[model samples]
Target: SRILLQDTSAVPTSPWTHFVMMAGSTLRKVKSRSWKKQRHFRLLEDGMTIWYKSRWAGKGHSTFSVTEVEAVREGHQSEVLLSIAEEFPADLCFTLVFHGRQGNLDLVADSPEEAQAWIQGVRKLIHKVQTMDEKERLDQWVWDWFQKADKNKDGKMNFKEVRKLLKMMNVDMNEDHALHLFTMADKSESGSLEIEQFVHFYKILTQRDEVWKVFQDYSGDGEKLMLEELENFLMMGQQEGERSAQLAQELIDSYEPSESGAMSLDGFQKYLCSQEGSIFKPEQRDLHQDMSQPLSHYFISSSHNTYLLEDQLRGQSSLEAYIQALKRGCRCVEVDCWDGSDGEPIVYHGHTLTSKILFKDVISTVKEYAFKASDFPVILSLENHCGVEQQTIMAEHLSQILGDMLLTTVLDGQVPQQLPSPQELKGKILLKAKKIGGLEDCIDETLTDEVSDEEEANGDAESPSAEDPPAESLTENDKVKPRKSKSKLSKELSDLVLYCKSVHFHGFEQARLHGKCYEMSSFSESKAKRLAKEAGTDFVQYNTRQLSRIYPSGLRTDSSNYNPQDMWNVGCQIVALNFQTAGLEMDLSDGLFRQNGGCGYVLKPDFMRDGNTQFSPEKPEERPDYKPLRLSIQVISGQQLPKVNQKEGSIVDPLVRVEIYGVPQDQAKEETSHINNNGFNPVWNETLNFILHTPELTLVRFVVEDYDKASRNDFIGQFTLPFTCIQAGYRHIHLLSKDGTPIPPSSIFVNISISELT
Candidate 1:
């Protein structure tokens, strides 16, 4: 192989010396007097240049001469160099080798695994001689090769000559073997090796005594190192290694693949290799794709169980729940965001503040959780329940905090100005619109209200009365009616489909998670068609139970029917993740099914081994019942509503209370009251049905007639209702009394109505 030199030996005595690297045969000796001016030498080939300078030479006033001491090999060039250093350095001091110099050593490895193993072995050798105590033995061994390989007594070895010597010695003629020699010989790599080439190559191959010694220095006593230990080592090295970890971080931060911030393990491994070497041959590297190959990495519990962040993270107070979710094996973390007035993003599940949780340190906690990226490298699919502007602000905040490290997607809103642009992160930002419709809208407001009255009547409104029974379920053999409709799936969801395509366009690994099931049918058709037509990136996601049920006939995963994988190559892709748990029964007491619980299920680790694994039995344990509904009322109008306090004349909206009639006489007296003038002003709004009272009242009364009829659907019984209104705030009013109570009046009653402020 050809070698390049950065400095010339004649400059050794100068304050700062330089080495002139060129084709071994083209190098000329520098005149002693010209040493001061020859601080550096460069080798040029095909308009590319490799420079060698005094800076590359060790701390002493010493140098080496580059010369062609061997004949060129059939497809390789070899060089030889004579060193005149005061003392041998701890490590091998040679230049780099270039592919152009190899000529014909173009033996390629079909798989990346083969290439990685071969390269790692060579790197180990270089490290051993650098930090160990066998410097003298290493130096002597190399020098001996130099003398033995100078076949013509010309003090230089050429490429062809080196190959001839290897053949003469019966060396194994393999790509790995050839690479070892080439790397040692062409350090500066001016495309040809000189005396130094043969010297380094021979020592690396023939120095049996020092080979094992080098391995011992870097090995962990023949045991594999823990990941944490390796991580620490990597971090430390990045901080203080030859190239510095900062450079690697910068490169990673600046990278923008069209689709995602998450790099596949395979892709990242190649990146790591490239950072160390001059070139990265991903095809030849043994890349680990285990972590990123799954379509979906989320773990679901078959049972209704609630898992709290406190239960995970093993007790790291500062860690966010989302971060803990990753530790718990949840590959997809769903975050519900509502825009705040200040443009800040808030995470909460309910539609209003009374049902919300506000963490004072939410932002900082999120940052900590976000730092543990890659655990869920796909989209942090954010559901926006507020205004579009607020959603945009949230996206902006996320981008500012995460930079290029987070693959964030906000659903149902236009992107905000503050967030990193798709241009900035190289398309890391993803947007998916919500899909709503079909059976979702079937649960109308009246139906929801009827659904909520089961406890009151001590009976459920039966599904489709016997006289007018429910319609027969449709089947595959049945004829279906055609209807004109747009998929209820929102633009945000559509954007996700597009985003995945974009990721593939930019050559990145991609994934997604679809939780809603209402528009499944239409979504499946349109998204699949669009992805096939537009975005060509692969989609790896865990389908909901509903989706899987629809897939066989609806999605057609078989290649014969739909070549989803082909879509990836063509710029569209789809991969369904299996999530069938045939036998795991979860405890309802585990809180998984709580209205706003963190996780909707829980399972043992063994159950999560594979998609096909069944859950084992749990020991008998205590169970808890906590699903009882809690009720409170709000005033949308009248005097009980939110007050406009103008000290001189404070005005408040009216109060509306729905009182239940049944319990003790004392309780009835405590709860009932007569509507005094202060409360029965007669001014009303649709939301004000109960009696309104002044702020000074201890209690007031409402005469509600025929209240019993409200308790039953399709029933005609009616009873009087009476209510007491105290000076409680709008939110404190009674919407429903968990335990039925009595009222004062015997004939009066009231009606309830839903209200919207605007």
Candidate 2:
């Protein structure tokens, strides 16, 4: 009954669809206020494409598929549309945001109803495209090729045209096999194949023999899989446990083409390509980890210099940088505060040519977006180089702008043995800076104190926030500038710093004896790495009670990042990276924080969470929970990979690189040989092996690169997931662009198997 209601139901049609199909409309295309020109736009008869051209003879027309559009904003929500808001009303404006890096197209209508019709009409079309199943998407891709290959615009394609289409689709097919399939699909004997017939030819051409073999092994006959057979297959083949029966029935109902209790070949294929069939486990996509532990018991996502959008030397600082960082689930951000030439304190690199903005503005932006992505606490790591006067101003702005969200004192008015948990301070922002004495010493009087910057343990550092000079602005003589560690502190600013007090680091023995739970220390990457290597278990014990921050080295003037896995291996809570940079380091950081609902605080493994833990990152095999997992991955094929360089005429020669990042013993990389000249759909059936000593903190990265013997290989796309969240089966790993945005229809299919490494 439920299946009948879902299958044979009538969907009500909207009037906007009729309006878009019948009479075309003329709208003003907006680039800027001065470039608003009249253009005639109409929806194609297929309702899957939109065509637009200027109202002049010289202006050529252009058509774009409905699948290209990502979304439609109903009002002036874009920068371009907002720029020309004085001339156009907000209700009359709409923007079409396209997939990938395509620029948005803004348009204005004469009437509100016309704008409403186009907005709703385009939304309906986008919904239809998004709801298409795997088989329908495959058919659409083939039908689009047929339409492009049929130059005469006829409704049919001849054998010669079909043969040409094969080459265009990156298929090096045999001529005899192509002719045989074409003749079989040409059922009307009209010497040509229609759109439906071409789709049939595609189904036969791309049939999965491996999938058929598995299905036949489980099915009673050879065609369909009943509930019992499907459940059995789910348990044995997909690595599902007691829930396999419910999961199998749900998959059949959701993916089966018809209203039947049994699953067919098409339905099974769709289920295998769905999210359940993806490499990452579905449960890990939500908040499934414990959040009631102390703040030091989790690995927090942190940013090194969150205000810079480019090179740290002379990059432009904007509020958008803070917004972007917070939206990407960065729980901790660094702010370098210096006394401005004006009365207000400003934010920028201390001794560089980087641009500055008002400190209040940064606080305001942080206030607006602090909880946008994650509700857990956000730590504002303040590098204060301001005098007592401007420091008071910075304190006022922080308290006023971040009104109720700031953690002014200890959580719950109690100083516990350990710090508060993320759940205890969900919507709060914690300030990490130099304090006068401690949390309870908030006296209402100014004090003269020696306020030197926390010198890095590297022994040659300039300052804590050594946001060094321009990329190449170092003088030959004074490599290490003189330091003045004396300044005045006001009671107003000092009171705001409760928890997360910045302190200097003595040796490990001194820290173990005197370090308070609320006191934290920042270490340079080189120093932290040396400490981890020298005393791995001690560093892990220190992090069990107090938070430690690891930042990039000062020599990185280009704002490049160092791999954070070494720091994280020692159970460091906040390993900061240049969030503005996109590379392998940031990829590992994002991957580690991507689990636990992406709340930006992933709990440490059990062995690393105990203060008396004897587990050493350098020797993870000594831990009790160190059961190694033998991971075997078969790189099967690539499907619809985007070309590395879209402008070049040559197709890409692609190769796949699978990498594992964890303890030193588990870190490894393997690559497949390059396919000569195909980026569209290349298949390489190669298997790679990895043995993970500590699978709890492991991350697997899949990178696709276009191989080039002439120069360095160009990057195509990459996807990374935590090893514990990986699913075992024949799964598709959806690819993401270099900046971590999805490119539609671009994925890699692989078969994964894992067992206990005895």
The numbered model that scores best in TM-score is: 2
The Cα error of candidate 2 at residue 398, in Å, is 2.6
lDDT (CA) for every model shown? 0.27, 0.80
Please, what are the lDDT tens digits per residue for candidate 2 over residues 1-758? 00000011123437755575447889998886678899889986566778888778576898898888767777765545766778789889888867543556889998888887877778777778888866667667777778778878877899988877776665656689989999999999888999989988877877767667778999998989999999998888778879999998899889998887999988997887777888989899889998999999999999988888887899877565776688789999989888888799998987888988778878877887788789999999987778889998888888888889998867666656799899998999998887766654443344434333332111222254554332124453333333445466666786787768777555566678977898888888877888888889999999999999988877888999999999999999989998888889888887888788888999999888999999887898899767888999999888777766644345778999999999888899999999987776688989999888989889999999999999999999999989989988788998888777775567888989999987
Task: Give the number of the best model, judged by lDDT.
Answer: 2
Give the alpha carbon lDDT tens digit for every residue of 1-758 in model 1.
02211211111121111111232111122222222222333433211222344544575332221111111111111111112112212121222222111111111122333322222322332333333322343344345435545566665556655655454332324556666677666787654456656656654554322213322333355232223333333345222234334444443444322233333322232322231311111121222223222222222221000112221112212222343333222223334455555656555533322223222223333444332322223233333455545544554555565455544343223322122211232323332223222122332312221211211221111111122111123332221322222112222222222222110010111112322321111123234444333332122121211111001112222211222222111211112211111101111111111111222221112222233322111110111211111122222211111112223222222223333221111112212222222111212223323222111111122212111223421111111111121112111111111111111111111222222222
Residue 498 CA displacement from its true place in model 1, Å: 4.9
Deviation from native of the Cα of residue 53 in model 1, angstroms: 67
The TM-scores of all predictions, comma-separated, are: 0.21, 0.83
Superposed Cα deviation of residue 582, candidate 2 (Å): 2.4
lDDT of 2: 0.80
